[model samples]
Target: MKKFDKERLLLAVAGPVIALVAAMVLTSVVLVASGKSPVEPYSLMFQQATYSDVQVLIINEAGMYYLAALAVAVGFRMNLFNIGVDGQYRLAAMVTAVVGAHMSLPAGLQIPLLIVVAMLTGAFWAGIAGVLKTTRGVSEVVSTIMLNAIATSVIAYLTLDDKFGVPVGNNNTTGVMHESGWFPGIDMGDSGEIYGFVVVAALAGVLYWLILNRTRFGFDLRATGASQSAAAASGVNAKRMMLTAMLVSGAVAGLAGMPILLGDVHTYSLSFPTGLGFTGIGIALLGRNSPVGIALASLLWAFLVKASQALDYEGYDKEIAVIMQGLIVIAVVVSYEGVRRWGLRRQQQRVGEELAAAARAAGDENNGNNDSVKEVAAR
Candidate 1:
């Protein structure tokens, strides 16, 4: 059992490492094919990533990615694809920004209240898809894609009027949140300010780990994901688990935009960052839906995003960065599956050897028992 566990751990760790190496090699080939020096791009990327200001930016960006990926991972563990995280976070952020703008409470109360409202709004929006899935057999993918459009339209309509938005220069946006509602930034000497909600993202990762690995509900969720029919036979309520997963996913998605909204922009505007939720899907896949893996993947993804900016100055197409990211995700998913199959084969071989050895020992004991009985009878 100990050996088996060690092998499992080794495989888990090695899978990602192998995947990354494979991805780098493939990306280099692509770069060479395009007549670019792979070494130059990678060197530039790493050099820029090492700068203090760039490091802070990477962390801040990674924080948001981490939260977004966590949101997607929750649904993934339950076999759900929550593509609506984009819509959920955007709508939640807009509503929270609007609410925060109207309130003038102390920072302690206002921030939490804003966050709660965001979570509730996101939950409600995602719950619609879950409810439809359970009650009307609607596919979450189709429903979520439709929900994204609906969310965009809703935001468009709401922000066009003075009721939910105010004109700021040429753009429409929610009123700026009061200082009391803003999260303070962290100073890093010469590195300017890092978004304080990085801590929140860390806490979310810890909580996700605990809930998915250390709770009974998590067991039911994993079981259902493994085999819904088996989980049902074991008395797990598939519908209830699905609903809970979706709600939790959306609630986390609510936080995906909070760091940028509360820590920097302090408003939800037409210029707010979008499509991060979709990016989360790729990050989650690259991480294999694990917390630690997701954090690392988020950082790597953020680094690439930051590093890509330097390409414009270096006379290289920035689109190559996107291609690398896409290739990494695809390569990682395939490599992980390959590693899983290899691990399964090794485990099966070990089990077979153990069973064979046990059978031989049993046969020897039976022969010894017969010889003893015959000797006793002769005496």
Candidate 2:
């Protein structure tokens, strides 16, 4: 249709498609080098992932990944890389677990309180980086990476034997939360109960889209991302938007763990999931930071995760999935750049063609006028 629409297609559709293709090709090569048939392993992965239990697991895991992707997307839209989401989420979950364990609030109130505590804890942790970036000119990337290390130490200190830690077998945990704080899930019969928090994650996605695509603050966030100086010239207060974006991202990151905390584990323990924040970065990139895109990306990620385990049982290395994931992440970056350059080239070609057509039309008009003038001179 329009040139702008064409360029957007390259971004929203073409990039992911190209990335998937490239990742698959590279993964196949890896399998071939290992003296294995690439097709068989993939076929097995897909077939095994079709089982009912695995499907349930994929959906449940996708819920968590979707939340994390949304969190990363928030910062992504503002050109902020909040690498400390790992720390932010861990600290938030730990602190929220402690609160949920100790508090004895009424029904509904306890869950809300714990969720609030999580969001606030995540925000506070991320805010330290925000404050450093805006006030002291420290790079968020450096500060956030450092924050993750600091968060681990802080969690360790808080969970010390003589402190809030409750020894559960070989590991320490922030004792199980009261039943009042537990979120209910939908029963899937033999498959398993799908995390109730999945519904919340979906709602969060909708809210994210609305905020980014339908609000002025979103416009400011995007503007700042595109060009901080330009946004500043337009009176958008770029620094404030940057800080706000980081805090919002952290707030969302806190929710990434709730599906496990409230729906399954009901506590913060050494077994709590980690590296999810890093995973979210890849999902966000693969999804191109769109709400729908992120959802699909999370599903694909979860599918690979569930299917990869099946590989181990089949005498195949489960690390194949990890290699694919790594390649996909790398391909996403390359594909985006490639598509962007292609779009630019296409746009230039279109402009050149239009200008050439206009020039030809002008030449025809001039020739016709000249002929008419010669006729008059002849007469």
Candidate 3:
């Protein structure tokens, strides 16, 4: 049994590594077909990776991305699909920006209030889909997708109108938010763009881990995810769990938008909240839904994005960077699924063996009892 467990563990660890190598090989083939030297680009990427500022940038960016991915993972844990994170995040940021722009509150009150409001806005947005799924029996996937379109349209309409719009001269953007609402950066001299939000993200991760691993609510969620019928039989409320998961997912996603809205831009704008939600799906998969793993994966992704931006200076194709992102996600998913299937098969085999052994023991006991009866009857 020890050996079998060890073998399974090894396979679980090795599978992703093998898949990454395979992905690299496949990418190399594409590079060759394009008449580009894969070796040069890869070497350049490594060279850029070694800089200290670049390292810090990766860390900062990764922390934000990981937070967003964690939101998606929370839904995944409950077997609830929440593709509406994109919409939730956008609406939250927009609300926060608008509030910050108009409010005259002090820095201490304003910042926390914005963060709280953002979280509530996101949760409320996601709750709409949750309500539809529970009350109307609507599929969350369909509802969330439609919600995204609705959210986008709403933002567009609000931003275009003179009464509420940001003065972007007919463009969809909000006015600059007040300085009091901005999140301050942790200033390490000569370090670029590092914010206090990294610490917030770490705290968020710790809180998430606690919520998922130490709470009864989390147990119910996992139970429902494993099997809805079994969860129901065990007195778990699967529908409530789904609703809770989506709400939590949206709150986390809203928090994730803070770095961009409060740190970098200090305002909401059209296309400003772009792609992070979708990118989070890839980050979550790469992280394997584990907090530490997700943090590491986010950093790797950040590095790739930063490196890709550097390509413009070297006259290299920026599209290659996007390709790498897609490839990594594909590789991670394929690897995780393969390893999961292998583990399940092993578990099933173990269960079968245990059942067979129990049957044999029962049969032997019955035979022994029969023999004793026969001897007594003969006497």
* Candidate 1 residue-wise lDDT, 120-157, digit = tens: 99999999999999889899999999999999999998
User: Candidate 2: global Cα-lDDT?
Assistant: 0.92
Per-model TM-score versus the true fold? 0.96, 0.95, 0.89
* Pairs that collide, model 3: none
> Can you write out model 2's per-residue Cα lDDT over 43-78, one digit (the tens) per residue?
998997889889899999999899988888888899
Q: If both were scored by lDDT, which would come out higher, candidate 1 or candidate 3?
A: 1
- Lowest summed lDDT across 10 adjacent residues in model 2 is found at 3-12
RMSD of 3: 3.4
Worst 10 residues of 3 by lDDT: 163-172
Quantify all predictions' global Cα lDDT against the true fold. Answer: 0.91, 0.92, 0.83
List, residue by residue over 18-101, the lDDT tens digit for candidate 3. 666766777777888999877777777778888878877777778779878988999899888788888888888888888888
In candidate 2 the C-alpha lDDT for residue 85 amounts to 89
Q: Looking at candidate 1, what is the lDDT of residue 183?
A: 92
TM-score ranking from best to worst? 1, 2, 3
Query: How many clashing residue pairs appear in each of the predictions shown?
Result: 0, 0, 0
